[model samples]
Target: MSTTLILLILCSVMLSSIAQIVLKTGMSNPGVLNAVQSGVAMQMITTISTNLYVIGGLTLYFASAAVWLLVLARVDVSFAYPFVGLGFVVTMLLAFFINGEVLSTAKVIGTLCIALGVAIMAQG
Candidate 1:
C-alpha cells in the first residue's frame, strides 16, 4: 500500500476509535444512564440526540465511514479491513486512559494479538 492509503486507513481507524470513546463518555453521563434506565425509548433518544458529546461522536462516525469508503474504493477488502482491528487497540487504550478503565493481562495479550494480526495482514 502506498503511504497515502496507509494513512487513510489509519485515519479511519483512529476516527472510529475516538468516536467509540466519545460515545462511551456521552453515554456514561448520569443523565444519559438514567434515560437508558427509564425504559422509555423516546426519552433515551431525546437525551442522546441532545447531548453534544453524542452528536460529536456520531459526526466522527460519519467522518470515519467516509474515509473508509475511500479506502474500500482504493484497496481490496481483505487488505483494508484488517486495519480495523487496530481500532480495538486504540479503543482499549483510550478507555484505559480516558475513562479510567482497567487493563487486565488478558486484555493486553488480546490487544497484542490484534496488533500482530494487523501487522501480518499489512505485510501480505
Candidate 2:
C-alpha cells in the first residue's frame, strides 16, 4: 500500500481509539454513573446526550468513518479490515495511560497477537 493509504488507515484507527477513551471518560463521570446506576432510561439518555465528551467522541467517530470510506474506495475490504484490529492495541494503551486501567498479561498477549496478525496480513 502507498504511504498515504497507510497513514489514512492509521489515522482512522487512532481516531476511533481516542473516541472510545473520550466516551469512556464521559460515561465515567459521577453524574453519568449515578444516572446509569439509577436504571432510569431517560436519565441515562439525558446525561449522555448532553455530555460534551460523548458528543465530541461521536464527532470523532464520524470523522473516522469518513476517513474509512476513503480507505474502502482505494483498497479491498479484506486488506483494510484487519487494520481495524490495531485499534485494540491503541485503545489498550490509551486506557492504560489515560484511564489508569490495568494492563493484564492476557491483554498484552492478545494485543501482541493482533499486531502480529496485522503485520502478516499487510504483507499479503
Candidate 3:
C-alpha cells in the first residue's frame, strides 16, 4: 500500500475507535434510554438529540464513512476491511483505560489476534 492508503486506513480506524468511545461515554448516562420497555421510540430520540457526546460521535461516524468511501475507491475492499479490525484493538485498550473496564486475559488474547489477522492480510 502507498503512504496515502496507509494513512487513510489509519484515519478510518482511529475515527471509528474514537466514535465508539464517545458513543459509549454518551450512553453511559443511564437516563438516555428514557423509555425502553414502554416502547416510546421518540423518547430515545429525544434523549440522543440532547446528548452532546452522542451527537458528536454520530457526526464522527458520518465523517469516517465519507473518508472510508474514498478509501474503498482506492483499494480492494478485502485489503481495506481488515484494517478496520484495528478499531477493535484501539477500542479495547481505550475502554480498559478510560472507562476502567475489565481487560481479561481472553480479551487481551482476542485483541492480539485481531492485530495479527490484520497484519497477516496486509502482507498479502
Candidate 4:
C-alpha cells in the first residue's frame, strides 16, 4: 500500500477512537435518559434535546464516516477493516483515564493480540 493509504487508514482509526471517547463522555453525564414510562414522544424529545452525549456521538460518527470514505477511496476494505481494531485499543486506553475503568489482565492480553493482528495485516 502507498504511504497515503496507510496514513488515511490511521487517520480514520484515530478519528473513530476519538469519537468513541467523546460519545462515552457525553453518556457518562447524569440525566442522559429517562425511564421508558416517561411517554415515547416526551422521551424522544428529551433524549434529543437534553442528551449532549448523543449529539456528540453522532457528530463524531459522521466525522468518522467521512474519514472512512476517504480511506476506502485509496485502499481495499480488507486492509481498512483491520485498522478499525485500533479503535478498540484506543477506547480501552481512554476508558482508563476518562471513566476510571480498570483493565484486567485478560483485556490487556486481548488488546495485545489485536495490536499484533493489526501489525501483521498491515505488513500484507
Candidate 5:
C-alpha cells in the first residue's frame, strides 16, 4: 500500500479505537442502563448528549465512516477489509485493559492467529 493509504488506514484504526474507548466510558456510568429501564429514555438520551466522551465517540464513529468511504474510493475492498482487523486487535486489547476483561490462553492464541492472517494478507 502507498503511504497515503497506510496513513488513512492507521487514522481509521485509531479513530475507531478511540470511539470504542469513549463508548465504554459512557457505558461505565452507573445509572446509564437504570435510566433506560425506568422509562427515562429521554433522560438517558440527555445524559449521553451532555457526556463529552459519548459525544466524542459518536463524532469519531461518523468521522471514521467518512474516512473509510474515502479509503474505499482509493483502494480495493479486499485491501480495506483486512485493515479492519487492526480495529479488532485494538478492541481486544482495550477490552482486556480498560474493562478488566480476562483473556484466556485460547483467546490469546485466536487473536494471534488473526493478527498473523491479517499480516499475511497485508504482505500479499
Candidate 6:
C-alpha cells in the first residue's frame, strides 16, 4: 500500500477509536442518561446536545466514515474490512487504560486474533 493509503486507513481507525473514547468519557458524567429513566427524554437530548465531547466524537465519527468510504473505493471491501478490526484493538486498549476497565485474558487473545486475521487477509 502507498503511504497515503496507509495514512488514510490509520486516520480512519484512530478517529474511530478516539471517537469511542470521547463518547465514553462524555457519557461518564453523572446523570448523563438519568433523564431518560425519569421519562424526560428531552433532557437526555439536551444533555447530549450540550456535551462538547459527544459532539466532537460525532464529528470524528463522520470523518472516519468519509475516509472509510475512500478506502472502500480504493480496495476490495473484503480486503479492507479486516482493517476495521484494528479499531477494536485500539478501543479495547483505550478502554483498559482510560476507563480503567479490566484487560482480561480473553480480550487480549481476541485482540491478537483480530490482528492476526487482518495480517492474514492483507497477505492474500
TM-score of each: 0.97, 0.97, 0.91, 0.85, 0.85, 0.91
Ranking by lDDT: 2, 1, 3, 6, 5, 4
Task: Estimate candidate 5's alpha-carbon lDDT, on a 0 to 1 scale.
Answer: 0.83
Q: In candidate 2, residue 47 scores what lDDT? A: 94
lDDT of 3 by residue, 41-120 (tens): 89877886789999989988988898899999999999899999999999999898888999999999999999999999
lDDT digits (tens) for residues 81-120 of candidate 4: 9889888898899888877899999999999899989989
- In terms of lDDT, the poorest run of 10 residues in model 1 is 44-53
Taking the tens digit of each residue's C-alpha lDDT, what string does model 1 give over 1-124?
Answer: 7999999999999999999999999999999999999989999999989998999999999999999999999999999999999999999999999999999999999999999999999998
Q: Write the per-residue lDDT of candidate 6 for residues 1-124, one digit (tens) a residue.
A: 7778868887899999999999888877666756556667789899877888889899999999999999988978887788889999999999998889999999999999998888898786
lDDT scores of the candidates, listed in order = 0.97, 0.97, 0.88, 0.79, 0.83, 0.87
Local error of candidate 1 at 102, Å? 0.1
Clashing pairs in 1: none
What's the CA error at residue 61 for candidate 1, in Å?
0.5
Per-residue lDDT over 9-121 for candidate 5, one digit per residue giving the tens place of the 0 to 100 score:
87888789879988888867766656656677789887768777788889999999889888989989897788788787788898889888789898888888888888898
Better of 1 and 6 by lDDT: 1
For candidate 2, write residues 25-121 as lDDT tens digits. Answer: 9999999999999999999999989999999999999999999999999999999999999999999999999999999999999999999999999
Clashing pairs in 6: none
The C-alpha stretches of model 1 lying farther than 4 A from their native spots are none
TM-score of 6: 0.91
Q: Record all residue pairs in model 5 with backbone atoms less than 3 Å apart, i.e. clashing.
A: none
Q: Assess candidate 2 and give its lDDT.
A: 0.97
Deviation from native of the Cα of residue 16 in model 4, angstroms: 1.4
Q: Name model 4 segments beyond 4 Å from true.
A: 33-41
Task: List the candidate 5 regions with Cα displacement exceeding 4 Å.
Answer: none
**How well does candidate 5 match the true structure in TM-score terms?**
0.85
